[model samples]
Target: MSHYAVFGHPVSHSLSPRIHAEFGRQTGIALDYTAIEATPAGFAQALDAFAAAGGKGANVTLPLKEAAFALCSVTSERARRAGAVNTLTRNDGQWHGDNTDGIGLVRDLTARLGLDLRGRRTLLLGAGGSARGVAPALLDAGVSELVIANRTPERADALVDLLGEPGRAHSRYWNDLVNEGDFALIVNATSASRDGLQEFSLPFALAASRTLAVDLNYGEAAIPFLAWAQAAGCRDRVDGLGMLVEQAAAAFELWHGVRPDTAGVYATLRGKDASLVTAD
Candidate 1:
């Protein structure tokens, strides 16, 4: 069996192995996908160890996405554009990086969730790796406006500058939520929910009746924000489970030169109702 792994700091909670195992079973690819805990300081060493162990490909997550990008010998245009890498292919002793996060998020929102993103006013919370990986795609998906807010305003501003769409994308302080007006879509992309570091402290006014709140997190990490959206009266809140499945399929395709049926795997993960537990 070919070796594969996912690297991140708090990766013990990952369901990548389960998702990928299902993909391999569907596609007849013999592969082992595991998650490893790696901090920023030790990521390179950990990656070196994996590569030494005959690893063929891997997935990068969380704070490690940019770190993975930095370690890549080559990266796809989307990876370059996003300045992050979520998928990695081993090529003759080199790591080739690509980002499928953007496409994954877009596919989930438009294709699966039945959301027409054209001209939707959106608010993206956080400007971290997850935010970077999906921001460009959201803009390209025709969100009329994207206001990025982060605890660190400079990071948010830098991401906007990278996007190079001042007319459509702007950066704001998280403290300015009330004045920023309601959005048709709000995405929680921060690691806060995963870290369990602090209360979300989001405003109820940030939601409109038409608003769809999305948290780029699933399982325990997803509850806080999705619950907030529910309590804030937004009916169509979504967790990241679908995006996770979609993105995993993209990564598996890149690694194996074949695409597996994601619907079955996603359905399996999602259970009989095919609805997130967050749904009413």
Candidate 2:
């Protein structure tokens, strides 16, 4: 059986093993998937040891995605654009990196939710790896304009500069967002939600017309954001669970050359009602 695993710190809560097991069973592929807790200082060593042991592929998560990007001998264009990588594959004695977070978000919003992003104003909150991974995909999906807001304005500016002029993307200070008019879509890409921070205030007018509010943090972390959106009168709210499953499917395809049926797997995983599970 081929071996695969997800690497991250505090990986005990990861549901990746179960998700991949379901995928393998459904596709009739024999494989073993597990989660390995790896600290930033030892991530490269752990990856090397995994590859040395004939590991086929690996999914990387928080505090290490950037490290994975640095360790890769080569990377996909999307991963390069995002400045981080979440999936790694062993090929020709080298590890290649790729980012599936963007595609996952796009698939969930466009394919699953049946929402059109073409020419819509978007507000992206946060300036971390999650924000970087999904920004390009949103731009590519034809969002009219994207305003990246962060607590540290410089980071937002840096991200906008990194993305270039691909599709009308810009930066804004977090507090200044209230005066910048409403957005058709608002995405919470911050770890603040995961830390149980108090709800941030946003203009009630922001959700004027079918605004979709999505939080990149899932389970317990997602509750605060979803509740805030609901209280703010934005009915279309979704957690990151769907994005997680979709990204895993993308990673599986990259490694196995076959995309598993994500809908069934996603529904099954979401039904478990677990708290603080890590998908990416």
Candidate 3:
């Protein structure tokens, strides 16, 4: 059987295995997908073992995305642009890398949510890999302006410098966000969701009734941000579950040459059947 896996530190909580299983079932392809947790020091060795064991493709998350990028013999332009890789395919004894996060977020926002990003003012709440992965795609979607606010302003500025789209994208300190005015969309791309209800405060001034607030983490991780969005009277709130499914579908297609219907799987996950699949 063809083998696949997701590599991460705290990977036991990942939904990739079940998502891919549903995709395989839908596409009439049988594959083995598992979550493999490895320490930062062990990532390279663990990956080597998986490859030797016939792992054809893999999904990478968190700290491993950048490491995966470094290990790739070839990379897609999007991966280069994001400075990270989330999907890896074995090619002639080498690994080819691609980033599906941006495309996934775009498809979820545009196709699933029916949101028109053209000329929309967006506030991206991080300068980390997750934010970097999606920013270029949002710019490509015709966002009029993107203001990245990070606790460490320099890191955010560094990302703006990389993108080199000065006229449309800029970085701001977290404190200055309140004066930036209302945004059409606000994406929480930081690790804030993982920490739950933090002491951090969002600038409610940046949100209007028409603003769409998105937390790039699902389930309990999304509650704090979504709650703030609701209290601020934002038009809508969403979690990253849709992006997760879409990106997995994209990776599955890349590996197996078939895209699965995400709507059914998404529903199954949201309807509480997600925990039925064991990580091991």
Q: Which residue pairs in candidate 1 have backbone atoms (N, alpha carbon, C) closer than 3 angstroms, thus clashing?
A: none
lDDT of 3 at 63: 63
Tens-digit lDDT string for candidate 3 (149-220): 888899899889878899999999898877888999899888875645453378778899999898788776
Q: Write the per-residue lDDT of candidate 1 for residues 11-125, one digit (tens) a residue.
A: 7767788889999998888888888899999999999999999999999887799999999999999988788899999998999999999899899888887889888999999
Clashing pairs in 2: none
71-181, model 2: which lDDT tens digit per residue?
999999999988889999999999999999999999998898898889889999988788989999999999899999999999899889889974598998887777887
Number of backbone collisions per candidate, in order?
A: 0, 0, 0
> Considering every candidate listed, which one attains the maximal lDDT?
1
Off-target runs (Cα >4 Å) in candidate 3 are: 196-200, 273-280
Name model 1 segments beyond 4 Å from true: 272-280
Each prediction's TM-score versus the true structure? 0.94, 0.94, 0.94
Q: Model 3 Cα displacement at 215 (Å)?
A: 1.0
